[model samples]
Target: MKITVSNWFKSGSPWVWLNAGAVAVSVVMVLGLLALIAVRGLGHFWPTAIVAADYTIPGNSQVQVMGQIADVEEIPAQRLVDAGLPKPGNKALIDRQLIKVGNRDVSGSDFVWVVKPWLQNVSHPKDAIALERREWGNFYGFLKDVRQNGSVVASGTEAWAALQDSIERAEDIYSQIYKIEKKEIGHINSGLERLRLKERSLELKGTNTPEALADIAASRAVLDAEYKVLEKELGDLYAAFTRDSIQAQTIDNNIVDINVSKIVRAYQPNAMGFFGKVGFYGDKIWEFVSDDPREANTEGGIFPAIFGTVMMVIIMSIIVTPFGVIAAVYLREYAKQGFVTRVIRVAVNNLAGVPSIVYGVFGLGFFVYFLGSHMDQLFFPEALPSPTFGTPGLLWASITLALLTLPVVIVATEEGLSRIPSTVREGSLALGATKAETLWRVVLPMASPAMMTGLILAVARAAGEVAPLMLVGVVKLAPSLPLDGNYPFLHLDQKFMHLGFHIYDVGFQSPNVEAARPLVYATALLLVIVIAVLNLSAVAIRNHLREKYKALEI
Candidate 1:
């Protein structure tokens, strides 16, 4: 038996089992981490019940506290005593609860921590509505009355019904206002700026004729008249939106009139059925995916970050694929296998190990400063001192990332090219095919799956890259998307938001850490999903190509 066991170890069976165990452990750890992130991130959208309770503090009067239970923890009773709180008799641990008593404008803070030992009479109040606002985080209060133009329009049970109706109208109006201001007004502004630039250009050429000046003036007048009409319409919309308000009694027993226009949605989580909660959860998820961020990025959605990340990746892919493929083709196929080639290969491999921030600094100095400054001087002198292309933007960011990931693509493609049988190339040449033709028609096609593998790897690296992007183009809060209804439709010169940067900003830079924590998890999860989707797409394409050329290679 001892000899058999020793033979098994000598035969490497034990080593095989050890390696397998290691892999299994690694997979389990990754899955566990993902499960944790998913639970913490996705659970944030659930409609948690609002609790109304009388919180009693030792040596102080009791006050009514109302809000959603955000978190709970157990602390040493001695710590509470050290903080000047009267100790509970012989208790080693005391429970503490974090309540999200939002109504920041009224309560002066969005969250508060209360000791559970001093609390009593906690109840979930169905009438306590949680208001998601467009401005100040959220409001937890009881609906008392609905007012219109400073008059009481509805009160008691009727107020809830009235509030619902008013919010629908306000949201509709808000959409219209957004369209007019962002679309109509924005177009006019662009047109006006272009005309100014055109006139300036003509002046520089000493061709600022009276007729040209008159034509520009005529266009300006037309745009001005259009702007006035939109301005008046916008004013009317604002007035109508602010006309209705709801009188709500907060947890602290203070009455405040909240404008209906500011309220995004109102819900009584305690009153919601299971199905109602599900529907609410779905809506919250949609809002997180579709809406723009607000309230210092502690509230609202991250649509811009999503859009920017996807768009940047697409742009980077476009820029990187061709350049990387061409470089690899030259190095592996055309270049002689000599000392110079070896040196170049070594340099390419070394670049892959360089820190990403080093790339950021290089991108900022070379792409944004050197190349962009030259382009602005030549093409956009009219916008000089202000800097058009002479700034970090989508184009520079894409180019920078393309350069950063170029080595991966080059190395992968070279490996693919090297794997092809020499006989395949020789056979093509023997069959009246030139080297170029053989490479283009036969070698490249068989190598396509490998090239796609490189692209998948490139995208995986680029999608989560935050450091380089910060110096290149990523911003905390981009006012508009890089792609829009504006002229040219895709503005490569615009600075854009990014999911990785959003996670970084919200996680570390936010003023409200507690509120932003869940968002960080959510955004991180979203970024992982985005990268996975991109890689899966590339992998699918690669699989198809591999199957198509399998017989050819054989």
Candidate 2:
């Protein structure tokens, strides 16, 4: 029997094949994108060999260049000529390389582009050093001497080991200094602020008696004493931290002195073997995830951003789930199927399509200004003018996201509630169960999977949202996590960092474009992973709920 093409079309086979092919293509594209992001982002951690070379342009003196090869690209020779650089030969296209010369304090730039044809006698020197610093970006050079108290203690090859030892000592001192300044001193400052607020509150209430004043003064004195001790300790640490210094020679043979305390890590990349490079890569990856961002977010770790993002999503989930479920229940089980109900449903659906920035603006107006200002007046009048809750913060950001995602939850839950067989409700009624009891004991339980489905979708969308968070709470840098070891451990009123905003800042707002570009990809990959993890958690719960209720469906 011959099968006609028309008959095959009529059988819907062509449509099925078309759909499968389309889905396959989409899957491949998504995987390809992820692969590209992973390669570009993860590759940044691998230490590349630093190349030292003499570069000369036509009729110009040769200049020494030393740094890691950051990027290589081919462009039309005309483009280089337009920039007043001599074109090489008659080639239409030429390759150029971006070199990270480091020594930003001396050169005033982190990177430089050089035409490949002009580079001569490139070599990777074994003694060359790459120093990652806390400021002024990286430094690439050769160690000359190690100094203690401005006196030379070690020179030549001995300086390398001495430099490492001094770095370790400085790091130990820095750890103590960090603890005192950021934690102990910070705690003392908070205490003083609280005391001041207490005194203010008493004055406001007409209870600023002499005894109260005495007690407040005593507390202030104690805090002041503690701060003084910490200040002395910090001074001593800083003195010690600046004691050790290293002299190094740049590729141009210029000698410079760098304080040991400023260096985060130093390594000889050209001398490292495969295993050594692997270890270095692992350490870099760890630092990226665990350390706080530095250098306008072009360097350091994004731990704070990760923390804020997760905390906001969790808070949003807690607030939205119950409210969404309640609204869905009322609409699906109790509300009359009238014009108002239909209109409300239409409005809910329409809200899901609104731009996210609109929700941010609404949150700023309604949630932050109006509601938060009222809250401050009612409960925190002593902290007035400071606007405790009347600002963009974690709570406002979470609530805004909850509102943005509420429609999804409502629709999903209503669908679940509607799927129940009428006979199930009838059986419950006949069994003498009240409507509320039926909903509590059976209906909601059976519909939990769908609610979770909604939550999963909500999280997936909310975690990746940048615009709404930017207005409500996210910032370029957050000095502390929203959660900390302070009183009222979780401060919902505090502004916090977020991964989405970090990516935006690093990609678009950073001053060092070459340094920040790789980080942008890294941060984007991290955001995708975070959203995935949140969704997968919800999905796991949803699958469990579905399995538990499978028998009831029959």
Candidate 3:
């Protein structure tokens, strides 16, 4: 072989060959992400649609669970956004509660509202329901009733649905009232005409004229009173019809008697746009997300879990970043290279090596039952015995994660600081810049990219680490979200829902294991997406900071 001048273009050394292998790894990673996303997303599209039969429920009532069919509303993409509420406008558009029953076309406005994930052959379907009764009703028929009103209440889908039965009933009543009012008024008018004719006859009377006048006058007065009553009734009818006060919601009386006035209950397709429904795929997605925060199958949706995840991550980041950065700065710039530094370095590295499950045990023992219970006694006395800080809290979870990831942040930050030249620091001191000022302005900026990278990695690792969180902050189900409808309502003490736990519960602890498998894939897809998003954000930030520093490199 010719000993050509060695260059990158022609290099065949093992290191160069390894560099080439990196390209293959990159290709594999990209393909893997794509394939996983497709598998999860398509799984959402092809959800099992199993129709449930009418089974006898408690109190001798029968509930029918149709099946879990493609909602026609479910769309594509992995990693679903949070589905946490019963919000009215576009907010409720993401709910995948509507099922595509039989040949029903969901794209057009014509539909019958059906319960999502139509429960099939369950001993009890009530245990899985999150909303009021969902039965077959003509969604289009309700719209027709609204057209007769020619108002928002008339033309509106939800509004008409809300009062469909009442509107139809009101229309009927008004029709009857229209005929009765006309007939009663006609009768009264005729009576008045007869009374006038009688008066004329009395005036023409000879011996009996005066006696007839008194009797006729008495009859006329009674007829006039009757006319007044009819007029008032007509007026009341018109007023009631005009204000839409008489419109009522109609459901299968056989199913539920939802009093629209006193205790109004409404069904809504809990999703919006084409894509959102596509993501929701089958009603099972809806079933998977919803719950009352206690039962496993309740359709309250994974709102609590989402809130917990975001809130905990934010808290963890806040706690870990400053502390980790400060420790790194002190070790790199201020601490003498003696026993203290050596000891700290060993401790920091050792902390990283410790198993994550150990941290969870620590959190549960020290944080939950001990520290949290103590705080419950002092600060939240009213909520005591319930264990405020003593229980798994988002705050505690965040703190726990912060503790677990601190070493990674510190190590990365210290390495970044060490890369800064000693000459630069000496020059800064010679230029009369204080150590603190130089470190703050020059050192930190240079090290920020690395710190951010560390944080990114920490977030990626922490978000996926279910074992530690399983012990500390996360719960199988949270009753109310950590945030709620109270004054200054974001409660840190509250236990939170988590997607990881959902995967665990659905995969292992669920009664309907076969039904829950698709959900497990969907959840796994979501977790992967969440991790990717965090990592991508870090990569973007690092790139931007690197660009900013490149100009300073010369």
Candidate 4:
């Protein structure tokens, strides 16, 4: 048996099995982590039953509490006493629950911790409502009545049904208001800014003559007229949206008026059926993917962050690919294999090991403060002080990342070029092909797979980088997307959002820590999926190229 084991080790079978076991363990660990995230993150969208309970204190009157159960934990009873809460008994361990008693406008807090033993009565009221509002996070209450123009139109059993209908109508009007504000008015504003810049340019060149001034005036007049019309329409829409309101009674029995337009969705999770829940879950997932964030990014969707991350990655790929490939080709095909070449190659390898934040600092100084400021001074003087490209933005961010990942591509491409047999190049040369033609037509094609492999690795690393992006371009919230319907649809100078930064900000910087926790996991899962999708695409192309060049290699 000892001889057999020794022979297996000598034959490398044991090493192969050890490596296979390590790989299997890694995959399982990764899947397990993803599963945990999915359960916690995706479950956030599901409507949880709101509980109404009477929380009793040792000396004070009983207080009614209502909200979803957000989290639970066990702690030593001594800890509660140390924290100034009255200890119930001499028990070593006690259960504590964090309740999401959202009504931040009234209570000033969305979450509160309560000792489970201090509860007098705990119940899930069927009539209880959980209102997802555009502001104030959420409101947990009972629907008292629905009103239109300050008169009660719905009460008792009819209030719930009426509230739903009013919300639908309000949402429709809200959509119209959004379209007018972001699209129609946004376009007019862009045009007016352009006209202002044009006037400034003409003035600087001493071309502000009567004819030019008159034409500018005419264009401004047209835009001003359009803006006035849109402004009036927006006012009318807002008035219509605010016409309906609902009166809701909090758990403490205070009646508050809530505008229907402010509510995103309202449903009694305790009363919802399976199909109802499925429908609600689907809607929430869609909203998370499509809508804008609200409540300091603790609530609502992350669409802007998603769009920004994908857009930045694409721009980085476009900028990096050609430059990396070209540099690789020059080094491998043209440059002599000597000491200087070896030194350059060594420096390129060293660059890959540099901290990513160093690249951010470099980009900020050279690209934004230097190159961008010069360009603004030369061609965009009218928009000076405002900075435009002379700030951290999409273009600078892309360029910085391209520089960071350049070394990886260079190394990969060179290895591929080296792997191509010298016989292939010599044969092409013998067939009356020039050296340039031989290198381009024969050598580069085989190296295409390696180029893609480098890109895949670059994307995987760049997509998840938050520290570098925060300095270069990523913002907590971007009002407008980098790509829009403006004259130059793709705005390289615009500041943009990113998923990695969103996760960091929402997870760490949010005032409501408990509320933002699940969102952190969800955003993280989404970022991983995005990187995986991009890497898989490049990998597929690489595999195809390898297959295409297989016969030549053989």
Candidate 5:
């Protein structure tokens, strides 16, 4: 056979052209996605402008809409008194209310001010929602303070302490009720004991003579009379206690009473910043990251979402890495290439192809409902009918993702194992190294990059998954952080917020969908960035390993 080698390339091979076309299409798709994210996400930080305004009440009872005030300066205290403005709260003479008396109707409706320049003489009084003429920096400064100081800038803690004191007060009230109820319960229980004693005594009545029987009857009459009195007292006490507890609880849980304690313990600076309102927004991410879920608008920002996303990814990584590596090692290093092995491999691959939504259902049905219900039955019989694992939870979500990504890890690892020379294994055996030692010390180090590659892919997939999480563990909002200061800190069964789902919720589920559209784009951009960062870091680690092992040509 004459072996002739040609340097010429194939000009018309459809396979070559087809591969190039595929690569081009992939590149375009990736680049387009990146561009879209950048344009929308990065745009959220741009500054917006605001205008000044003045309002005047009509002489007649009508809605008055008025405009521009001519250079209305904040009246200093002395100026305020000279102008005869009301001096309320703690302020210098200039601490009087701000007002603007403009001539025309071209007033500012767009720009906002917290300490708005109120016209000293109000011609119109309908507009109470006065935006101050304070600089936007005031808003940013307020947010910064909240971020640094954490809710209590001044009397926030006092308010919380007062609330706590109220809670203790409620406890005292309950204790008093319990004490009252205890006396009645004791009487009822005593009567029951007497009745039981009488029953027992009757059993021995047959053994006694006529004189003994007469004496027993007399004693029984006294006990029976006592039982009637006890029963009557218990009935009265139960009725009274039931009514009292219900009444007290109604008072304890009163909207006004609860809000009063909340009001006392709440963080309400006389001059509130934008962060103060973040809690008021009632958003889930804000609740974890800020103090007042309702009153806090910006203070309860997305920091908690960032924290949670990172934490969840870390948890998933921990769960998947070891099991994945072990499975791969078994398949490639030990398993025989027979019918069973082929079947297992096929099953693993098929598992990867399973819809993530299906995995979520599996997690909910098996992990949460079946397993959790069983656990509750075994451990917490007292709390029956309440779920243990029957509720959606973070642990189930993590485990589900781990199972979902297991195939990737296994396949990559097996490929890496196959690439290692059989001679290396033989050589290690000849040198008296055990198979276990060789596999652990030699095979593992070489296959690390492949293992990491699998993990990276798995993480990317898991990070963006929303449908599965929606069914299994994701909640619209949770009052407490999944990880918190509570005992046994990481509450895995607790539900959590996610950026991917947040985008969907804000964009679709929000009452003000139009207002939330921009936020949706921004959230999507952030999620993509997070996933990219994780993937890039994993790739960097894989590269480092590749460089480290270049000398050991597998």
Candidate 6:
């Protein structure tokens, strides 16, 4: 039997095929994007061999260059000619290489572009070293000597091993210093501040008695003594940290002395084998996830950003879920189905389409400025003028996101409630079950999967939101996390870092574009992973709930 085209259309097979094709295309696109992101981002951790080359400009003498080849591209010869660069004869396209010459303090630039035709005698020297620093970016050179107290203690073949030993010592000292400065000293400072605030509160209440003053003074003295002890320990550590230095010879043959404390790691990339490179890559990836960021967030780990993002999402979930469920129940189960109810539903749906930044503005005005200011005035008057609760912070950011995603939860729950057979309600009523009891014991449990579905959507949306968070609380860098071991533990009033904001800052706001570029990709990939993990957790819970209630659906 011949199938007519009209009959095929009538059978809906064409539409089904079209939909499947569209879905296939979409999945492929998504996977392709993820693959691209992974390649660009993850590859940044791998150590590339440093190339030592002689580069000659069109009208200048040959110059020695040492660095890793960061990127290579072909550009139209005409474009180079237009920019007053002499084009190599008869070539339509010129291949240019971007070299990351990381002695930023000396060369004044992290990267330089060189035309391929002008590069001569390129070789990777075995002795060449790449130093990852805590500041001034990376340094590419050769180790000359290891110095102790400005005197050469090790040189020639012995220098590398000695340098490694010194770096280990310095790192240990550095860790101690970090603990003292960031944790012990920090705790003391917080205590002092609280004491000061208490004193101020007493004064404000006209209770500044001599006994109260004595108590405050005694507390301040104890804190001051602790700080002094930490200060002395920090000084000793710093002295040890700066005791050793390394002399490195740059491409220009100039020897520069770098303190051991400033160096994060030094490696001879040219001498590394595949396994060595793999080990180095693993270390770099670990550092990216575990270390604190340095150099305007272009370098170091994004652990703080990851922490803040997860914490905010969790807080937002906690706040939005119950409120959303309640509102949904009221609308679907109790409210009369009339013009007012329909209007309310319409308004809720429309809100889901509103621009996220608008929610930020509303949250700032209503939640932060008005409500938060009132909260500060009422409860935290001692911390007044500092704007404790009356500021953009973790709590405000979470609340803002909760509000932004509330409509989704409400709509989803209402739909779930609507899907229950009316006979289920009738059966419950016939069995002498109260409405509240039925909702608590039967209705809500069955609707939990839908609620979880709504939460998944909310998290997927909220986790990726950068614009609202920017206005509410997210910052370029947060010194401390919102949740800490401090009193009242989860300090919701603290401003915090976020992966989304970190990506934006690294991508756009950084001074070193070349250095920051790879980091942008890495951060974006991490943010996507974080969102996926959060969503998957919710999805798993949702699936479990659905399976648990499957028998009751009839």
Poorest stretch of ten by lDDT in candidate 4: 1-10
Each candidate: what lDDT?
Answer: 0.92, 0.94, 0.61, 0.92, 0.57, 0.92
Residue range 29-127, candidate 2, lDDT tens digits? 999999999999999999999999999987889999999999999999999789888889899999999999999998899999999999999999999
For 1-554, candidate 6 gives per-residue lDDT tens digits of: 68999999999999999999999999999999988888888888899999999999887788999999998999899987898878887889889999999898998999999999889999999999999999999999999999999999999999999999999998898889888887888789889889988998999899999999999999999999989988888888888889999899999898898999999999998899999999999999999998889999989999999999999999999999999999999999999999999999999999999999999999899989999999999988999898998999999999999999999999999999999888888889899999998898889999999999899999999999999999899999999887766666799999999999999999999999998988888998999999999999999999999999988896
In the range 1-554, model 1's lDDT, one tens digit per residue, is 56688799899989999999999999999889888888889999999999889988878988988998888998899997788988876879878999999988887888999988677898998798999998878999899999999899999988888998999999999999999988899999989998999898888889999999999999999999999999999999999989999899987779988999999998889999999999999999999999999999988899999999999999999999999899999998999999999999999999998999999999999999999999989999878788888899999999999989999999999899989999999999999999999999999999999899989999999999999999999999998889888787899999999999999999999988889998988998899999999999999999999999999888
Q: Which residue pairs clash within candidate 4?
A: none
The alpha-carbon RMSD values of the candidates against the true structure, listed in the order shown, are: 1.4, 1.3, 22.7, 1.4, 17.0, 1.1
Query: 4 or 5: which has the higher lDDT?
Result: 4
Candidate 5 per-residue lDDT over residues 119-161, each given as its tens digit: 2333321211121111110111011111111222223323333
List residue ranges in candidate 3 displaced over 4 A: 1-15, 22-26, 46-300
Clashes of 5: 44
The TM-score, computed over Cα atoms with residue i paired to residue i, of candidate 5 is: 0.56
Measured by TM-score, how close is model 4 to the native structure? 0.98
Tens digits of per-residue lDDT for model 4, 221-303? 99999999999999999989999999999999998999999999999999998999999999999999888999999888999
Best by lDDT: 2
Relative to the true structure, candidate 6 reaches a TM of 0.98
lDDT of 4 at 310: 91
lDDT: which is higher, 3 or 6? Answer: 6
Tell me the lDDT of candidate 2.
0.94
Whole-model alpha-carbon lDDT for candidate 5: 0.57
Q: What's the TM-score of every candidate structure?
A: 0.98, 0.98, 0.58, 0.98, 0.56, 0.98
For residue 122, model 4's alpha carbon misses the true position, in angstroms, by 0.9
